[model samples]
Target: MDEPKIKNMEEFAAVSGISRPTISKYFNDPDSVRKSTRRKIEAALDRFDYRPNMYAMNQNRRLTKNIGVVVPYLADPFFAEIARIIENHVLSAGYRPVLLGSHGDPDLEIDNLENLRLIKPAGVLLAPLGRVSDAERLAAFCADVPTVLFDANIEDLGAAFVGSDNDQSIGLIVEYLCRTGAPPAFFEIRNPVNPNANKRRAAYIKSIEALGHKPHLLQADGEGWEFEQIGFSEGTRIIQEHDLPTDTILCSNDRLAIGLLSAAYQAGLRVGLGDGCALRVAGHDDHPFSRYTCPTLTTVSQDYAAIAQKSAETLFALIDSSKHFDSREETLFNGRLVMRGSA
Candidate 1:
């Protein structure tokens, strides 16, 4: 037999013989109500199979339990992985997580913030699209909401920022490459969309210069988030033209390094640290696929778990306090050097 469908809380309240406020109180926290009232609500729940319209109820409240988690380029495994962790934390903390992707679009990023605002979320955890983000819009949104930035940061955009220390990660790889092989030449996109790329590039130059080796930059002309394609295309050109200044290459990130590895295989150039291997390659971010590459990739591993946990905790604290932080906070977790066969 088909059961009755209670479409609204008011209808459920009527059917359950409980006042709307009491039902709401139960949903918010059952223990807040008297023991007898709690048993009545439980009995009604089991009998009617009634599900509260949480969104509608929350909308009427000053602050909703929703926590927005926005990430750039969710299709990328790195971002996807971090988003999953953040979602789990939000859930475990008794808050609802609303996950959204900017899809590497600045306008879409702004639209996401606008939508989140309408939800009256208790707080938000955002991984902004650094270089291409509409800073003015982002800053305005942050001012209105308790937001914590992560992954990539825009200056003064949120109550706090959490990300990897690109300088440390890049320098670690540079020093390792120089120690075991020829000083690495930098491989990166011509116009990087992510702010981390710029940091890594500068770190590479600084590290190489400090070690008394001149930095050689091999820039590939490309844009957008298709890093692997750009890496492969530019790597092939470099290999075919024999334009590499050094036998070792340090890619801006693992996605690019993966593409470069593919190019090397296609161009008949062996990539590894052992004898007979013509080129040594390393990358950053320790992308999920890095470990499965033909020779595995030597890269810097971002503290994904730490970044996600800290970002979530920071946002929750801000939400609970219902006030802006005294000062903007910035936390950058260090990356670990993951040595593999490719280096």
Candidate 2:
């Protein structure tokens, strides 16, 4: 049967067979009603899929079960994968989900955020553009709209933050590379986009030192999220210039590794852990496309499920309270190493 479109609360009330005032109470908060009333509303909801206008509900200073999820770059498979996970959670929780991408542009990020504010979303799960983001604008937005930060965080912004533990993830890979072959040189962008890059670099240095091995960095130049291009270009340059100090390389993220892989391939340098392989490469994030590369990438996988759930849950809590948290909560989930053919 075709589901009837619910144009307004009146239509919803008529279909639900509940009084407008009572339905209003339920919409305000499901638990506000008696168990019987709650059951009735829920039953109607299941029989005919009807969701209140998120914007209208918010305009009345009442919450709608609407959430906004924004990412720095959606074209990147990593963000696409994570956004999908978050969307499923929002749908299952009976909230409408909206997804937006910044395309690695700060202006677009601010614009997306402003658009979300106009909707007056009950809450938002944001993966900000890190250092490029307008912190003041974001903090002010969060102050008015319940928000949770994930993927990247800004100090003193939002009600809470959730992300990967870069230290643990990078350390895991660095140790593995050292134990198996050579102390890998870290390959990264000279001007990286994500804030997580800095933490991963720190962790790489710490991990190598702790293992009694000297660390090296192959800092490449890049802007925005063109990680692969940067890595590839840099890798090519290093190969031509004979600048590399180590046979093994660990990248800040998979995108850069992808670029580096291309460079190695063009240079006819074999990449793998086996005897005949001339170079061994590893990366972080285990990007969705990582497994499909010519030589499947060996990388650390972020706990996307955990990050999504934690972000959603924290945003909901802030929405329920209708207040910003005085003390911001920071949560970081660890990454698990996945060995592949590459390294």
Off by over 4 Å in 1: 34-43
User: In model 2, which regions exceed 4 Å deviation?
Assistant: 1-54
Give the distance in Å from residue 46's predicted Cα in candidate 2 to where it truly belongs: 12
**What digit string (tens of lDDT, one per residue) describes model 1 on residues 1-343?**
7658888989889888999999888888777999999999999888888888777788898988899999998899999999999999999898899999999899999999999988899999999888999998898888898999998878888999999998888888898899998999999998899988898899999999999999999999998899999999999999999999999999999999999999999998899977799999999999999999998999999999999999999999998887999999999999999999998
lDDT of 2 at 236: 97
Using TM-score, give the best candidate's number: 1
Score candidate 1 by TM-score against the native.
Answer: 0.96
User: What is the clash tally of candidate 2?
Assistant: 0
Q: Which residue window of length 10 is worst by lDDT in model 1?
A: 50-59
lDDT of 2 at 11: 94
* Tens digits of lDDT, candidate 2, 195-250: 89988899999999999989898999768777778888988998889888989999
lDDT of each: 0.92, 0.89
